[model samples]
Target: MTERVVVDPITRIEGHLRIEAQMNGKQIDAAYSSGTMVRGIELIMQGRDPRDAWAYAQRICGVCTLVHGIASVRAVEDALDYEIPPNAQLIRNLMIAAQYVHDHVMHFYHLHALDWVDVVSALQADPKATAELAQSLSNWPKASAGYFADTQKRLKTFVEAGQLGIFAKAYWGHPAYKLPPEANLMAVSHYLEALEWQRDVVKLHAVFGGKNPHPMFLVGGTPNPIDLDSDSAVNASRLALVQTIIDKMRTFVDQVYVPDTLAVAGFYKDWFYRGEGLGNFLVFGDFPSAEAGTNLRDPGSWWIPPGAIVDRNLNEVQEVDMRADAEIQEFVAHSWYDYEDGNDKGLHPWKGETKFDYQGRGGPDTPYKQLNVDDGYSWLKSPRWKGKPMEVGPLARVLVLYAKGDEATRALVDDTLGKLGADKRALFSTLGRTAARTLETKLIADKMQSWMDSLMANIKAGNTRTFNETLWEPSSWPSEAKGVGFMEAPRGGLAHYIVIKDEKIDNYQAVVPSTWNAGPRDPQNQAGAYEAALADNHELHDPKQPVEILRTIHSFDPCIACAVHLTDEDGEEMLQVKVR
Candidate 1:
């Protein structure tokens, strides 16, 4: 076995992730991605009442708060063939669209932007030059020398105080950071603004779902019902508040987030050449039309069409069926679990198992060392679409839309490519992945106004319905019913599979976006997207600091749930990650 480079619990992301790579001198030969934690949310979901399953399943990840809850309820609704009303559908669409806007913007500025923008470098920038850079990009009101100078002063204080705060533990002053000092200063100022912007933007979720971060969800449709006069319900005041929040979200995304992304990508044009992994993409279409609910299985009814693109071919779009047993499968061969039949055999989510089978390796008390890369070293199962590793997330969704010849997606993709003076092939790299997320944010944020208007129109038309009472009771369900609820999450495709037996959840499994992008190798030795992207380029200029790895992995916006605190026999904090 050759010695490899390891980054245990890669920082500046949502969860704990360890990356080990076998290096061919300066470049990576083979790379490995480990979850470094176990998620038993699927196991905990068994035997619970199907109606209450969303509460437990949504707790899977605080970062992806409402996606799990929405998926969980959709699974049960699909099983009973419950059709929600038009008003309910519009409300749900608003929530989902708001999630895309809020999450994508936050990921760009707070989570992923630091990979390109150097805060330390911002201190050396001329505030006037930074103002010029900002004003040239957009007419955002915050573009002023005084604003940037104040931000630079804050950075200096952070450095002088010997505590970097949110800017700590990063690869500051690294050669990989190519953004000019003025650009860095401008980006840093927006970074601080985004932190406050997200706080105000997330209120849209609270208006309909009752609260943010795992908001209330009903199995049939939506929790908040439209009543123009009632304060307890989604009244006129709450509706106005939601509208204001959506406008704020769009303003930030249009003026600050999108401009900053294009600016950062300009300096890292080399990233547009590499970071292509597997080249197989998947997306379960989301934001379905209320009329499409008549047959919820049709992808044509969805705003974002569901399809698969293989080997970087854009002309041929392969149809994806979440209901087919042969379509979506998970392998535990390279994971910590064991399938009763065979480890290598692929099992659909309906029959997926959550058996913990860590055999005497990397235990809590075991002396820590290198991961067993040749064997199971991660808790995440390798999810495949029809026996192939598929990359899911922003990049996949954009390519699928562009291949389907969506006019809006094409205009954005073509415009971004033109601005960078590159071809369509540039969309397959790390910069492309990050840029796609920003474009998708614009597409969704802009469309949210239409949804809000439709909801108001429904109420004025005397159609103030939210939840469907037809299948609210478990007694209405069949003795045994299995269904899959899928959507294009902020990160990528997310789904929750549920098997109901006698009104109880017999089996439940949620294959999140992070699992599809961050899982380890399969039995056939096919690498997941993370491993494949790391080997695409020698982003590792120095062995000690691998900013390239963070840039690529963070582009996926990894949400491997949250991290578990590890400690010695004495109770004390072992690790602490500064969250912005």
Candidate 2:
């Protein structure tokens, strides 16, 4: 009999999430992904100065908060038609690159590694054999006897540190952890190393901005500029240091990260074949330029198995409209907000009317009204994709980039696939999604270093210009304007749409990464990114310890911290608020 199996609060990932799997026997028949927690971020932005939006948006996610800040600024700048100097552009690129690497390393080692590589399993690993394995991989950090010994010492130190933090909450001894002891030891060492690396890299953001978590990003340009002679600019010595870090990163990607991913995939080949979510992809190109009327950072568009499906071929790709997509609308039907369900509804924050009344059932009375409300769920709003659920983040970006291949990207793709014993076809599956993210990280990192070097050269050649001659007053603003600023964040495409009036933000809306991944069902009852992925995952061995769930979700690098709230009566219904 097909019955519902819910994996609420899926662990070891960002944000609060629940996956309801329709099960027949031991396997899953279909699944629904839901995240309804957190409240009032967008609504809080109303009536505030447009510049303040960056400050508030940064609070979206502690992990990748800077992306939100950057996106916010970009939207306002787009609306205002202002441009910054080349140096500022380069500075922004470097800041973003640091965050990308930091997020990637942390997610790999701290967030996702424990599932495949066990810590306790290390006790059984033969140190000698592990050393050999490392040698065979060539140039791996853990290959040396000292590194292995240091790993043991550090493990003890972390244990003594007595703060596993999220790891403490992890199911370490669970049966799903299948790595050998030696492998576990190596992975554990990498995990600790990654944390340190991430901490150091985050400082890059702090150096330019005030803090790390949510660095202040400017709209027209950087509020500050590097004085080449003022000790802040890169001298011959500092440039060397930055270059050195890039070199080391390249080495790690080539010798350690790439090799390790491939090596681990050998053991978990099952992931390559299964958990293939709706195989459609979308990418709004990233990286903006100082020049106007030029799409310098053009989107190399591509789609694999592209098309929309109603219900039968539910795994096909579909684009849910952010502005008017019925599946994309917010409903106060069961939310805490008291409003007429028909006309005076949960207006988008740009036109929001906030009147909180938290009295409702917190759950839907029937299956047909699943998003109305439910009990025990938090206050976050629900975002729907194509009236159905979909998956977002890296997997989506990779698929999108691969399909829209330029000569440069195609070369990288071919080389990466051959090394992993994968072909173009295999990339249309779960493994491809994971591998694409790793590869893209390296690609973007290399490009960012180049951009930084170019900027330094520009400054050395006597160009101190960082801002254009543009007015900042109300007269500088347009009477009525609409524009969207899109960028590929560490997660996925993040877009912000703004409508301004007399230098004030009249209506501001944003599409965050989680809204793409974890949205609920829409009016036409379309599944979102996560829901589409879950529905395709048929082999769910343990609902309580769903390793498959973790793999699929992490492949998207789902970050629900960016999601905001909706008032719900039933408590089950969650709406995704894209408030400024």
Candidate 3:
């Protein structure tokens, strides 16, 4: 008999997610991914002023807070044909670059590392041996035996007190864990260090946007005012502070994050061969130059180019046109939604509907043990590019750049692949997805300094403007306007579609990265990225633990909170449970 294993509310991710897999003994026969909540942000955006949409949209997720705000304003600007000042563009680049470096590092160390590094195994590690191993990886200063011993002691306290806190509820001694004790100790030490480092890194966002977790954004340009003499504005002191934060980000990524990933990866080299799902990849492209008349999606000007790669082919990159009819679409056939035409039909974002037509096992009052996968299940809608399921995130973005023959991307990717002793084809698997995030983090972190220099140069040349007031009024817009605002967010490609009529939002739909990677099966019964990857040659060392399943899903850094945003301020809370 085929056995089914369920892992509900997968820990360490941004939102609630449940993964169910059908197993033929030890190997996975098939898998299903479901988002348990429903988001009404799209419906809430309707009939609101387009200028204020960013404020509401940015609340989609507190983790990826700023990305929605940036995409929202860009959509309004795109619709109005409004152009921001060159200085404003440079500032936006700096802010976004900071977000990528900050968010990617956090995801690797805090969210995904636990799946690979066995914390209980760290207790068996010799501090001296761990220090030696850490020293060999990089010149990170906290590699002494004393540092390792202290972290081990702290972990021991948590375990002894029967309160692992953040480390609680993990499958402690799973057989699938491949890291040695010393390596686990090293990763755990860095994990704590990353927490402290991130606190300082977010200051850069506050310097530019006035705060973190939901930075302020203007439609035509950035909200920050540049005044070298004014202490209240983005003056010389704040500019220097931004540079300092950038330096710190570069140091941690080079010294800690990259080195730790390689060290752990050396022990789990087999992961390079598994979890390669939907070889098709997509990126909308971002990081526009401050130069006059530069297009954001222009391959030559963008730091990360926008394109699509089909069948793992790197010879030619197909252009991604969001505005192209039927180029991008969402399917709700297997989702908890109903389309105006039919559940089987796909709808473009501009004409997207948010009708909730849930027909699951229960009527939303009581929860079911498992989702009814045959009909409507997930709140997430399957997103496809030109009728093909595509993977998005760092791996996709890096591959697109590599295929475009960008010098920096090719060199970094080639060097990393060489160090791993893996071929270019290895970039298609779970390990590749994890490693790509580190490589892209370094790339974006390094570019931040150059952007800072450019911003300062523009200010020195007497260009201090950061906002364009000409298009700030809704009266300046046409009676009807529609546009798409897209960006390469930390998780992957994120776009917000907006339809405005008479200066208010007629309709708005946001297709985030998780929607593409974690949605349920599509209209043609095509498995989404998460489901497909989990079913791709996945084997369970112990079905009771299911660590192998997490390795693949966490590699995508699944963020279902972006997909479904329902919350109850006053209601009976359900007791959380762990399923295996």
Candidate 4:
């Protein structure tokens, strides 16, 4: 009899997942990554105003919800042909920059660090020796005895404060977690500090967006008023504080992010050589300029290995391949849908339908190899990147942007490489992706500051009208307007397609970062980004210790909240699948 190994309630992610690995002898023959639960945000968006979609979309994922808000608004605005003002663009850019910096720091230190560094190990490190190791990297954040002492006090408080989720049953002394105790203590101290920093940086989103974990924004323009009646002046004092935060963040990134990554890399050097999933990447560009159709930092020229991997041809990508729609379509073939088109053939999501039936694949032998409809594994529909499995996330975006090679991006990249003691050859691995994010944040931060200054100049020059009145009548919307808004979110390329009728959302479709990273097998039966990375000969010492897998996956920073929704009884997935 064939044996099955299952990993349920996958930890260190935003949602619930179950991994079923079919082990043949000592190797994994096949693996199925299943999202255990469903949340239907799409179906619930059905009669809602297009502008309101941003509010609901942002709720898709708590961690990267701002991206959802941005993408949703961009989509609606794209459909309506609305042009936001220059000042509004700068504000959006700044907010996005803040999110990128805050998220990257928090992700590296708190979420992903536990895999490599042991907390308990910190108790044994000589603070002096650890400080020495930290010193070699650059400006070392003081790892003196006093710092470690304070770290111990903070960790103890964490334990006492009953907020141990950050350190839940941590494998502090595990073999894989091989950091010096002092180094560990230093990292731990910053871990607490990063929490506060993240909270502070997220406020940038709050100022523009009503709140985070989902923020309110406008399609035609920003919600914050900016006319003579509105008192929207740049708070120089507050802006100075933000500037200070950016500076401190730059120091932390230089001292802590780079150094910690390197320190951890010394032990986990294997990741550099492995987990290079798909090699093909797509970053649809990010942070559009004040002028429409003018790419300030062209994503077409990325720093990473560039080009789409459909059919395995490596070429510079200037535009989206319209042909991708010709071959790829989401499959309910194995889904609970009983409708004709559920498994019939490829159809665009706007025209896609869902139906439910629990009969499995339908054949004499089908029952043995069929998917259950009653309680399906995931609410997410499988999205095929060019009719094949592909990955999208930090790595993909960085690579795509690097390949495009905008002057600003390349210059920033070179300076960052100089800092990391790396060359172009090293840009294709996990370490490269990790290091690139921090560098990108700094570049984006500095650029945001420049953009803010430019905005103020434009305002002083007496130009405050940032929105165009493009209100189209429902009847005047033409036969059908099919438009796509492509943006680079914190994870990677985010896209939205909208088809409207009678001032109502007829069909609204999105391909989120997770849809690219965590997708299942397509018609070609290829491995997804995560699957391909996991397939790279993992040295599975313990089934419970999926640390390596966590590192590879977290490197992508998969966001499932916006990408999933369940179908109805006939196997048609619902658009709005909630956590509760």
TM, every model: 0.95, 0.82, 0.95, 0.85
Which tens-of-lDDT digit does each residue in 137-250 have in candidate 2? 767655876677766765656566886554565556777666677778777766776666665566666666756777777766665455655576444554555566666666
Residues 377-404, candidate 1, lDDT per residue (tens digit)? 7878899999899899989999999999
Candidate 3 residue pairs in backbone clash: none
lDDT of each: 0.85, 0.61, 0.87, 0.62
Clashes in candidate 1: how many?
A: 0
Kindly give the stretch of ten consecutive residues in candidate 4 with the minimal lDDT sum.
294-303
Tens-place lDDT digits, model 4, residues 16-59: 65565555654555555655455456666676677678877777
Q: What is the overall TM-score of model 4 with all chains considered together?
A: 0.85
Backbone clashes for every candidate come to 0, 47, 0, 44
Candidate 2: which stretches are off by over 4 Å? 1-3, 153-166, 172-175, 232-241, 289-391, 562-580
lDDT of 3 by residue, 328-424 (tens): 9999998878988898888899999998776654345433665667787787899999989999999999999889887888999998889989998
